[model samples]
Target: MVVIAKQNVVDILLMEAFYEMHQVRDRLNFFQEKYQQTFENFSVFMKKENENFEYFDDYMEWKAYTKLFDEVLKKIEELKNGNFQIALTALR
Candidate 1:
């Protein structure tokens, strides 16, 4: 049997959260470079113009990535602040 310290668990979670944040930032950057605009500007453009399938698809995907980035950032902040609860159970 092995025991893991609480701080170790928090460290692991923080590492993973940081990795996720990096990945989400990469995705957001991809969309920004591709369209040469921020999501808000792209959204406004989409609303003004006739709908194109590719742009619409990219918009939806970019929107999801944007939301995920925000959520991951929040998770990272919580982990850094020690605001998370965790339970560990041993396996037989």
Candidate 2:
């Protein structure tokens, strides 16, 4: 039998999420450059692609992956905050 801490699991998840996020980010940048269109904001890019849904499936998939990355990041932040609070309380 083996024991693993919850934080270890969260850390693993965070690592995976970061890797996936970067991959998607690179794809987004590649597509933007390929199309010769750049936007500082993801939402703006999404809006621009909305009109070309029939031809921009890859862009749309990247957008979905971006949203998933955001969700994972939010979970990581929550987990870190919870860990911090636990540490502070233990010290006190």
Candidate 3:
């Protein structure tokens, strides 16, 4: 049998949360790059078609993803500050 203390459990959970946040950070960077590349390609296509690329400035897909990415970043910060307990409670 294995034994673990309450503090140890909290520490372990914190470590896992930190790892998850790191992964989220990586995903955020990846998506940002992907979106930039796609947008650039789209702009090139619009220019070829003689369309105004400025209309994409208010693109809904881009806006929604940007908001979601920001939220993920904020969640990472909250997890870093040890608010996982509160978060877990909220989940329950």
Give the best candidate by lDDT: 1
- For residues 1-92, write the lDDT of model 3, one tens digit per residue: 46666567667666775676566566545645755655445446545654345445534455555566567667656655756552222333
lDDT of each: 0.92, 0.64, 0.56
Candidate 1 accuracy as lDDT: 0.92
- How would the candidate models be sorted by lDDT, starting from the highest? 1, 2, 3
Q: How close is candidate 3 to the true structure, as a TM-score?
A: 0.39
Model 1 C-alpha lDDT per residue in residues 1-92, reported as the tens digit of each score: 57788889989988998999899999999999999999999999999777599999999999999999999999988888989888666768
Residue clash pairs of candidate 3: none
Give the poorly placed runs of model 3, Cα more than 4 Å off. Answer: 1-3, 37-92
In order of appearance, the predictions have TM-scores of 0.91, 0.53, 0.39
Instruction: Estimate, for each residue in 1-92, the C-alpha lDDT of model 2 and write its tens digit.
Output: 46678788767766876787678678767766666764335446666665676446756665676677677677667766654332223333
Clashing residue pairs in all predictions, respectively, total 0, 0, 0
Where does candidate 1 stray beyond 4 Å? 90-92
